[model samples]
Target: MLNNRYEILEQLGRGGFGETFLAIDTRMPSRRKCVIKQLKPDDTTNTAPTPGWFEKRFQREAAILEELGQNNRQIPQLYDYFSEGENFFLVQEWIEGITLSQKHQQEGNLSEAQVEKILRELLPVLDYIHGRGIIHRDIKPDNIILRASDGKPVLIDFGIFKEVNNINGGNKTVPLGTPGYMASEQAAGHPVPSSDLYSLGLTAIFLLTGKTPQALTSDPNTGEILWRKDAPHRPSNLAAVIDRAVRFHPRDRFTSAQEMLTGLPGSAGREKTSVVVPPDTKILPPSRFERWFWVIFIVITGGFSFGFGHPIIKPWLDYLFPNEPTVKELPLIEPSSQINSFVLDEDGQTLVGGDEKGNIYLWEVATGKQKKTIAGQGKAILEIAISNDQQILASSSEDGTIKVWDLKTGKERITLPNQRGLIALALSSDGNTLVTGGKDTTVKLWNLSTGNLIETLPVEKEVVSLAINQDASIIVSGHSGGDISFWQKQGSNPYEPRIFPSINPWTAPSVAVSADGTTAASSSCQENIRIWKDSDWKDSPLQAGSSADICLIVISEDGKIIAGRSSDETIRLWNLNTKKEIFSYSPSSPKSFDSPRMIALSGDGRTVASNFDKKIQVWRPSF
Candidate 1:
């Protein structure tokens, strides 16, 4: 619009103090596309202009961007920077690619290889910046783009240039970066180089969870991120590295980007892809702004220590004084000797539950009183599947054994041993066929009455979720690789089993097959409920709804309702056709406690049951 040399195409987004746009720089004959950002100064402040300070800060930031672009291929090149009236504008290369945020939505939560690849690509960029005494105050998924042409990452938006920020004596109050990705020190405006690492770690977490850090729930007191349980594919090695990177205190985090990169698992004895830092390298000493942060830190620390001070404070005073309190007391979830998995029978009269200590409880559904209790096979019950008639209960244990308990007698009828990995159990309606799937990549069928081996199912992948039709004729099995196998009872191979592809296999750890065999509903780490229509699993879904914490899922007999237990101790019911949550049941929990592991829907789909740590409740849906 200014001088007719540039054309505004579309508004990209708005930040705290600026607006971003996509524009074509017609100044060049080729009319190349570029990004234009308008930085507006606060008009409300009446402080006298510090003669040329703003201009000097603007020029310095522009020069820094140019320098970074020249040295690093992953950074966006600066094209032009000019001021129109009180507002400033920056013109830069338009990255023809998707931001990591967009890529995450297009793809699933990043796989481990993707996370490692990201760490490998961007850590060096951080090393380059931190070496020059500049911290990329904003480093979230949105600011990092995956260039389509070369498949490389590009870091953008220096955000309030390091010098321009009023880090001196805490004058700048505007929050920097996106909320979830901002480090504690950055929020306090006393960021060190490590603060960037903290933001990077949070970005990695976002990729893994397909969720912003803000959506994740943290422990009330300790403030530790309770992310592991929700993100299904966190490998311990990578998780440990990320854990240290995002430690609450900057001092407790990796000192430099180089250290964090080198500390990764495969960096040992390898050629350095990332820039290397010198030994004993130290950042420039804290400025006037940092003294304020230190005073704040000391006061907060002293307050807490003295609040519980005296005898407990005296013993640790010497050590705490010498070092920051880096040790975080990650709160422990107090274990209640209670129900771990439960299921409601078709009649809704019998409520059977399996506890962490391998005990079975038969409760009167109407009165909520325990009718019988039997000690199980000395292992935690991972899942419980009830027979259609409410006569038999199948309890899958941590040790790969299925204990079949008689509902009437509360006696162990049979203990079916599986010497493989984790197992999922499902009992058929006629009380005849039993299906057992294991991580060992085997699905076996048994005669429920005698617990004898029937026929082995031909499933080539590690089964994650399993469900059976009422008469044991149709079984739907979801595998670790997002492919589903359907088994139909007949022929020499009998149940003709065929694999059907679905959402990223890692996500569909919870699946439910309608009793009538018309529909199958599945949920994954992506937090969306996918309904696959009768044997034809394709790109288009019947209906997809946003959801989470789907550790256990089940579909109604008519395939009209879908329900699941999420991580937040809630059981939600969804109308399959409308893709709406019909109703939900959530229970308030203590600061630290166990959560439900299993949830189930009855054969008629009229009842739902969930384990409440120490108790199990069966409910009739209001919707």
Candidate 2:
């Protein structure tokens, strides 16, 4: 009998709920190849009740497919869902790819880079699926297919996926995912984002080690994962991340993909890589307030003469007698010296840095040599800008001043009024316009040629970071409140701002827009960096460590290379195209700190610049 407009060719595979078939759409003489999945009639052995239950399940699956029709590239487009002689069939796009499990069998262990690339491609799809409020409970290797033509991975089989919050009342009661890959919660009946991560982690392990994870048999008294005598052949970081992901308890595993990526080797330093301060360098413990009170009492009892013998008491007494507040300790590095600003020149060839000491240094990207030093202002420099033609360098200083200098002669070309409380600055690609934000709660546009203020766009909060897209048609700014505002020139009201969705609620210290304007990266005060794509923003899959707060974010021209600095004093390189980390560097013994504050990638994506110990150092890949 014809199954709707399709004629059955041969059975492909069968599962508990349904049987999949290779079929042909015969309504047209051409007979296009298609896949049809038909729900099976319930039997005595199976508790999935008869006639009514099968029809309901079939209809539910059809509805899900209908809803997912909009995302056709990631998922097969559903054609038709109907019933024929009590048998319900679903016609869909026939995917052509080898199952991940088949790929594993054909090829040995995959490289860390390959696994990372697969994860990066798969994550965006997962994000889209999860955003629609669906949980793909079964995400084993068998369900993923790698297309031969483009070599892209695709996820198939949504039969076990359940609505994010509707799993409790479902009649499909058995455990959903594969045994070893399933998180304890999924195995015990609760499935969430963490569950999917667990499965993905296990899949990575299978691809990396060429071994299937087996059940753990613990000693009767103590519970632990039982490993064979042989160690798996995988990178230590990859192994550690997977071990944590598949832990017996959900809480023991990485909670998000971001966390897993953060822990991966080269993404963030391992726990052992932390700086160990020598005992001699440790800070002296503070004395208890009670001790101070006792000393004061003793001095009063002795008519203040006893304090002469106590040198510490003498200083304290003098301060107390004077009734003046003690001097506040100045920070070792001036706030302006913090290297909070950066600029990519018109040719993207040179980089210049301005510090709070009012000192400026120019460096050639190729040799990383200091070409010139300009010392004009006495106060700290808060921001820097380079002209599109590479003719001049502009700087904003704490003395409420903005100065423009000739690039060749290092002479002050122009100086604008001091804008007290300067926070961030940006220059248009053509270097014609300069935008500066300060404590005045406004973004000011200036003509770089004349050093004259052009327009003032008032904002509600202090702007923390600023970026201009390639065309200079749109300007994106991040505020202390963790909001990102997009300003466009073509809009009916150019001065009015539109806010992007809040992906992070803490202050984002630095922001970078891709040359193509399709992506944006922001580094936050909370040690996290978020990447915004299309209209929505998602936190980078990479996790930031406690001591390594993300301080800088930079993107390459092709929008493929992304680099960021951590409080851990290291720079991380990410390949967006491959969806894996490429390299990382932790300074040697004498120079390492808790984190690096700023980072920049050259136009060619070959060289990197970062600030440490009051100096900007350049780095290149070992290869």
Candidate 3:
């Protein structure tokens, strides 16, 4: 080599900042294979601000690598870093492995479980760097090496690589990371700990989709890459975690690497007792939404029968619905037996019913006779949602799976296997995304057409109830935390949740969003109802004052009216603008209300559907 202490064997690779060669230390008693890097483009007295910033920066990176290599096996050891004439050189341990990019090319797209295992392994490596007050700045598939002997990933090309290429090109020092892998903030000369997270998330997406970051489409307005629509079948849980990490804004990303790790599929709902995560180890636990998600699942499955409507769910239920509906009852259309869940088309013309025996029925509202029946289900169906065009019907059951059916042929289109079993779900207004809450205590967004997981929203609670706005711009969820929270979609920002006001901590709240997406309403177990438009309260809170607890809330598409039920075995209605009660229905009174498992409001805000036990009930309630 240059100094004669090493002998160059072959040229391995070359890049803008330097060239790498395979070499052996001839001076050593036992010759060992090592890597020799030749760094170039020296401008000691010219453009660089630090004057000799390149040399000093190179030395600093060597020290950092040396420390990391000694402590962690995933990093290559730095044996030497020196300057020869105008060129810089670093002799380091040669890692015999395949680059992730190479592996991706050889193996094609990896399975969700395979991608997840990579995340669980490499996130800790990033954590170790970030905790030491250093930012890797660049992370992509090409920069990671999969050791052939162990199959463990080894991180390469750290500090010095960034310092050479990341000049902000301004009066300030901005480090430019590789295109496609760069975080929005890093490009602006402000790289935070979350910056690396963005790159890492993008890398995982590339490995799973086999598409480079540039090939993915990004929303022109938010500048956030729309990878979910492209890789529709990727696991929803992992997608959700990646969505948070790669937000357009750094502040919206995970504050740290360890935080991102806890939200992935394997750790989201796991108990700490089962897996030991050391406090000093620097990895944080799951996000608040994730914890709330599990709690919701536990409370709904372990404590109540009909999810949001069960009176025993929270302390507030014990005192709610203090007085029975005082108005005359509305007209009733009844079903033959107890029904678990049902939906009414936009015109309230068609009724789709789900039963305990795993059968589905489509009935003509005018005739009250079953027009078509789709049979042979495996378990009791818990919830049902119809697409806006009335072309598809999605249903969830006790079997831990979700099925999408074509209305025209009454044939199944897609089947999603969810091991946690689904408890609550809603179809997006556009009918493309299906939002669901599962027994695993996770909230997920699915692409209906391809059965792809669009996002895994870790709400930290199981679902008491879930709702997404008509435009699919916002998601509001009621959790086992005994309150409803609002989640807004921002351009690549971390999901920040705000608590819905006018409710006590011990009350169980049921949330619903208007079809226009302009308004939302919540009916708490305390019999207290509040209305909201956008982010603020629109009207004074209304009370159902049921002689029993109020279980659920459903808002009309027009955002003008709402329908809810009480444990007093009655269905009640109210006008949002008038702030007054519309009417109440006691058609099946004297018989406990436990027979109706679910209820729905028509788009025109005039009709309501209730599944009484097994019988389907469609009624028109007048103000």
Candidate 4:
């Protein structure tokens, strides 16, 4: 038994610094099977890092694994990590499936369609990790396992040998990866994001030709692998994409996973089935026949007006019948940069948005026209809050400052500077108090009129989200460690927080509070959405969770409706009273992986606005 709980069943394999084993957890009632990786100092190496350095590296890797596995379903889930004596071990979810290498051995070779399917499904996962600044150094057939439950590929290992870098006065370079699959730059101890793409391209080649990189012939001068002749069934377009991915120089390859995804053959042509009614269609009642009769009458009698070709008759008909007030008929607003954060006006007639390029757009939702554009902070906007009266618009950015703007004048009101970057902001209903939270692990109440700090409440962890009740008597704050705290204002010394135990540690939770302070909801990635009610904060049956993992959530003002975005690139809304989903959709025309998604719902729960890349889409949801 390892770590006094896991019973070793069989040895899986061994790498340079670690060994893996299939084990069973004795602590669980089901005796669940898992994989345990053991890491230790290798005696064969000439130079080794000190024990402190090794321990730090092990801890860092464990944290990364925990974060990646928890947020993504394509990666194996990390259950536990601990140290026993000088050896470190990691327990992970055991995927019951065969590796691509084993699949090739049994099935001969994969067809072109099969290879394309893998590329399409796995590239988004790569984009996700790369967005967080992580590069998988090893991408090979053996490292990808097709899960038995579903055929999706689950990436494993994560390059355990990459941790052995130049540390503790060691001068020799240690290049770590499989000889036949690693990129040329990776082999020289310097790997870029494109290095992983290079290996993935070669993996595709191996799946097609049933030959590893070593067996393929290469150009002597250009150093490009020549394998098109071996895979005669492949199309020229796919071949071209693969060739570019495996280019000789890193600069010549695709810079990011999103670019490579777009380079695929049919990526642009793919789209989700939309339920939105077309703009030309009219959703009218029994007066339709009367309208059609008037139309026929005007065309016949207004021939003199129509013959002039001035559209005089059409203007008269338009005055009789106005355009339908529906989201489908509204003009689409396409901004220059991705919208990072946005909030809808309480009246549901206007939308305020902040973009990645630090610009604030005030859009008229009725006509979808850009009314004003204010130059915002220098960095990407983290959060945007509209006061209850819609007079003050406050936005937080990575530049460590908050800017308050006057909606009527389209001018700046005040600038609140912070010591660190602010992540969350909330405004009181009366527009007098503003609450802000940031990486500094403190929540501050600021007087909006004077731009002065009223009070600061220090917490044990950095706050990730903040919300205030209508009366400003209750404050809901979500911390980076997954703990949601509720603070009540009693007197001058009413800053102490009533803490709830951490939900999923280190995964920031999206939280919202009702305007009346009667309801609150929060959700962490890959976890169930929890609802709390009453002053005691007891659980309510109106909870909702999904297998897709809800990442962003917003509660309606009355607390009767909630909407959120999930990891599967879909938006969903639910009615808290009935506990049923009202509507769901994939909002983008051609979905792309952009950073910092923003969503807003009208107080009446009739309108929803969301950011889809460079576009802002508004919808009057109807089932």
Candidate 5:
């Protein structure tokens, strides 16, 4: 028995400074099991080392562990800590599951999908700890417990965590952590946030290849591990991300856990890495025909430009393409902040835009006049939706709340608290039903009139986009996991949802469904826009001739036209029946085109609106 309440059952493991033991708490009626660690001061006869320093270090690390466990569920809770003479003890929540090392030994190597899933789950935990300005100097397979209760990975053994404030040139640097798992900088006694990521990358490689890092060979020139050859079946994107994470230098590794998470396979935002070329690879000059083609094309264009100039060529070009509609830039009375989200009325007569300054601007489309300006949520707006009657406006921002405003009065009507900020919103034609998809992995339906919670539909992943059909009978949602789900209302019971897996299952997809609920479109960073038709959901291709991924898609109410904005800062419209592009517009300034919802299309698809820099550009088809 130790600490007067904990009864030791068996020894778990031993470290350089401590020994862990399995124990039970007798104070509580439940008598829960916990892991107790006994810390001892180094008895070496070195003048530099002292018992006072060891005591302070243990207390500081124990306080950090308690704080981390209380905040995150993935970390083990610290029960108690105390000093008995010169020795110290810490009791922690015992996780009842196998370690990643033991799991690997029992089940062999993990698949690419399994490795990615683990990375996604653990990165958020890393982000949480990193946000507190602490670096976990040790991250390895043996330190991670696959919790049997929920199958979630629980991070453990923060024995060598260094608070950023405690790091300075005066403090003696001591390299600590398991061999082969520690990063180069960490091994050299300077570990940053990315050093944990480096260890994680090696752990992932070990899980995938079923080989220890010590067994893996390293490049003599670059010092990069050569483990990809053993896991050759892994996707190139995943390989590239791991390679970047395990770079030799601290700056060469991912800057943060969130950055590495975004670089994961299927994420919409991918990080660019240097291309590795083989020693024997050679670059050849352009072929004779290719060289001649480029030379003749440039010469002909230059000759025509020189001969006609602007004055003569402008009229001739207008005559040759008389049907091409000219894009009109809207004039603002005052300088406006960058617009992040906007919506157009059903008739395309009015435009409502939200800017980064948390202000909403209403405009008259025909005359380019500012109708009214309303102060919105005090955060960058992410999405906005207008009521079918154009009488009500709903906007969501980064502040995690939804504000409903009266279009005519420009006064706030109601504010609904949406937990974990919404990414997509859909309003029914009657304006009575509002459907929202959020980072909470749930789609919520709310009553717009009384601001009452209606229903909650559970989804497997975080939803990125949403659309509702006429009569509020059908709802379509796209998820971060590249899933498209259809929720159909049958006689007032809870909506029955049917999930349809997307072709690109790793990226978040943007979705748009027609008012009739017969046609739907979905697109992601890894794939082109795909149109799903019929009740069974047979999909067809809609080629926009753009290689960039489409981040936002809007379909006409009648399901005849669909418009999408690609990552290349181009907005395009296509006729659903003919599958032909009506018009493609690439704005000169891409300042406001950085994210989704910066572009809006009317239900008729005749008018398109997008923000370029501080100005809104509107376009109409010339027939």
Candidate 6:
């Protein structure tokens, strides 16, 4: 049906706020294809003139688009915005090509070169967006479309976008963005330039890994991204750039897109134009403050009395106090404490973690000390991950988002959406792809470069644990049903039943794989740690143990050492080649020990670390 002079053709997409349809302009004889976005109304009793609050929001979006049109092709041109019944519709140009999300799904993870190519093109778009003081709060793969003819990424979807300086005065509302890709401040409803960088970093992660940022598990106490499996192979500079852009605190991320683009290999040494902060203006501190101050002054002047008319005392008091009280210098603010997570970058630098609470902490791995706890996040922190270069940090939280931060300047760079509470997260070896698992029960893959959700894998059962193989070819998921499923990269569904039998009636506590991907081991809460040989799955052996249960496990890259932790807080080391116990470590006093929650082994297989009750004990092989 044609609304006014526009002919509606096919529906493009539908979302919570509105619907997008591809249409043609009937007024023009040539019939040009265009896209129309219509806003859906909510229940409201007040029926005033003009438009309702939501309708006004749509009108604001229209105004933004119209303003953007001033810069040649900076944004899609808006043809019209009119009310049809109770719905508001907007029309604009329709560009062709699949979204970056599609590219990540089909390509698994993007290579460093490919990610750079895309980012080079994306940086300019961001520059334009930020130049106008506009922030794309909801930056995700679904919002970016790649032109099929030129492979250029075009960002779309402005329903939740915000203009930093054009806020309405009648109502104050929290800014909204996706969960996994939003910056800490943006998630807290304060939109800034760095928020966009956080989303862009997540987009890059999605491109490097076929998983979403929320799929990787984090240490609850530390708020750090825990990757005991395999680290993605990414260029140090590129990884650091993306990491810094998505730091937890806006202050931890790059201040501008140009700063992010500076780390690109070809763009290195190119200086970003500096922006000078405007001088503070001495203005009235709101009308209420002025009114309250005047009322107090008048009351004091009227109540005061002296022997005659208090002329002498009043003059003395006026001379002492003056007409206005001098503003006292604000006291220095004390920084708040923050929980931190740690990750080893490509160069082995100890990268700290950021949280939504505006806290950033450095991890001194050598001393196991948390240094420099900076107020980074603006709200409660959820998760944090470090890039290979130790220069970038990404954080997410209950605020419904993800953010990228720069470790050097402590600035936030990008923000992305993740409405579903992000629970687990993983980054590929290349640091280009990000995988996230959330309460939604689905594993979402993101293009970390573009802040897009590429592919979503639905696991009918609740996904309790997730691990990606070294080659990024297989994804292993441990469900609540006590079943461990192996998903191949080229399969219809990773959850499809395999010939492997269920080990226990309850979920396994932890799972690990050898670097070669030839051996798979699982530590079960039922007090069993089992291993399966690649060639014969049915011949898997279950390690005999009578402790309360196994809490964690780690397998060496060379398949030589296997470590397991029991709920009784005992560490058992085994020789994979001999299939026998090597040595066991138990505290001198059993009461002093607590169950180990997680374990990890060094590359040489000589060093091992087990965590329990916030303590990480390092062990070395005696032999």
Which ranges in model 2 have alpha carbons more than 4 Å from their true place?
A: 1-349, 365-368, 491-496, 500-508, 525-527, 534-548, 588-596
lDDT of 6 by residue, 1-623 (tens): 65768878899887655688999998888888888887665435323211233454456557667766546353567777788887777788777788889887777777888888888888888888776546678788888888766777877776343321122211112446665565533433345666787788878777766556555444444333332232366566676676566554444467678777876776858543333231211111222333344345434544243221232222223322322211111111122333333333321223354433557676443345555565654766655655433455676666667776666577776676755656656554334555666567777666667878877788666555555544445555666666666655544534333434456666544666654456777667674676767675443555565323766676654456777777667777777766666556676563533222455554335445554444445543422
Residue 86 Cα positional deviation in candidate 5, in Å, after optimal superposition: 93
Model 5 Cα lDDT, one tens digit per residue, 475-583:
8899887889988887867788888887876888888887667788888767888888856777767874562487778886667778777777788877787776756
Rate residue 179 of model 5 by lDDT.
Answer: 55
Q: Candidate 6: where are CA atoms >4 Å away? A: 45-60, 69-74, 160-172, 219-232, 270-623
Report the CA-based lDDT of candidate 3 relative to the real structure. 0.67
Cα displacement (angstroms), candidate 6, residue 359, comes to: 48
The residue-by-residue lDDT of candidate 3 on 1-623, one tens digit each, is 66768799999888766789999999788788898888785454235332344564466557667888888888888877778887778888998989989998999887788788888899999898865546787788988999989999888877445455433222112445675577533543445567789889899888888878656655544546677766636578788888887765454567567878877777956322122222211211222333354345435553354332221222112112111111111224454545678877754656788887888887766447677887626888888888655777888888777889987688999998664656689887557888888556677888888999988877666676888866566777777756566777767775566765444666656788876567887776565676778746453466545422667788765567778877554677777766666566676445444554467776546557775544556664423
Clashes of each: 7, 12, 38, 0, 1, 109
Stretches > 4 Å off in candidate 3: 1-337, 491-494, 501-507, 535-540, 543-548, 587-589, 612-614
What TM-score goes with each of the models? Answer: 0.44, 0.42, 0.45, 0.47, 0.46, 0.41
Candidate 1 on 164-187: residue-level lDDT in tens? Answer: 433222112233665457665455
Q: How do all the candidates rank in terms of lDDT, highest first?
A: 5, 4, 3, 1, 2, 6
Candidate 6 clash figure, as a count: 109
RMSD of each: 27.2, 22.8, 27.3, 25.7, 26.1, 29.0
Sorting all predicted structures by TM-score, with the top scorer first, yields 4, 5, 3, 1, 2, 6
What are the lDDT scores of the predictions, listed in order? 0.67, 0.60, 0.67, 0.72, 0.72, 0.57
TM-score of candidate 6 on Cα atoms, chains taken together: 0.41
* Lowest lDDT 10-residue stretch of candidate 2: 323-332
Model 4 per-residue lDDT tens digits across residues 1-623: 99789999999998666799999999999999999988776545523322244555566567778988999999999999888987788899999999999999999879888888888788888887765546688899999999999999988888643453333211112446675576644544445567788889989998899978756766544557788988957667777778877775555677667777877888886322222233422231212433465466556655354331222333224423632211122345677777888888654567888887888888877567788898888888878888755778888887788888897677899998664767789886557788998778888998889999988988888888988877677788988878888887866666657887665685788888877677887776766777788667865534545423677788776677788877776777887766667567774466765666667886546567776656777765532
